[model samples]
Target: MTATTLAPATTEVLIQLRPADEWLAVCPLSRLTPGRGVAALLPDGRQVALFLDRDGVPYAIDNRDPFTGAQVLARGLVGSAAGRPFVASPLLKQRFDLSTGRCLDDESVAVTAYEVRAA
Candidate 1:
């Protein structure tokens, strides 16, 4: 009978499939001015416009123009509802939901909205 002992490997390998938190820091609140909108680049390479409503709360919405698929929503106009935040498309003047990414005028298409904060 023969007995053999195996030695353990000294090196450790670690692989991460996804980020601990899906959120990636985009910008600082100081850089994102209030009452004005700024374009934020996401980790996935998509752009979103972050705006602060008249009440000074932050809202985020896709930067793409829903009608033409162009990246022009960042240059669009920002307005408010009874209190809800919204962005108007620069191309066709269509309004979209800042929270749920739903088109106010159209129902079939939708953009994306991300959770935003002061950096």
Candidate 2:
């Protein structure tokens, strides 16, 4: 395996509420497994669920499930609907748009979506 070079992350963005700065290198791109979601604990103790597709495209959202109030979104099933990537809540089976964090089952309830990119 070859090692890739990246600019040092001098300052970490404290995302108390949601992620910020599109260029923020939160983690190594290689850490994520395709078609699976992983939980990343932010500096503020907030847990964010990050999903990667087979193509290595990344999506991030709150790890909590609104219906059950459980922090298990990271273990949800990943799929796509109408060309939009979504993650189905493991507890309620509610589909959440990974790009926007909109709940397909309930429009009023939504989670925080974060912008992610390969470093």
TM-score of each: 0.73, 0.79
Task: Score candidate 1 by lDDT.
Answer: 0.70
lDDT of 2: 0.83
Q: For candidate 2, lDDT tens digit of each residue in 18-95?
A: 365434445666667888888888876788998888876788899999899999999999999999999999998999
After aligning candidate 1 to the native by TM-score, how far in Å is the CA of 77 from where it should be?
A: 0.9
**CA-only RMSD, every prediction:** 11.8, 7.1
Candidate 1 residue 67 Cα shift, in angstroms, is 1.0
Please provide, for model 1 over 1-119, each residue's C-alpha lDDT reduced to its tens digit, 9 standing for 90 to 100.
89988998664321111212655555555555556677766667777787767666677778888789898877778776666677888889888878777888888988977766543
**lDDT of each structure?**
0.70, 0.83
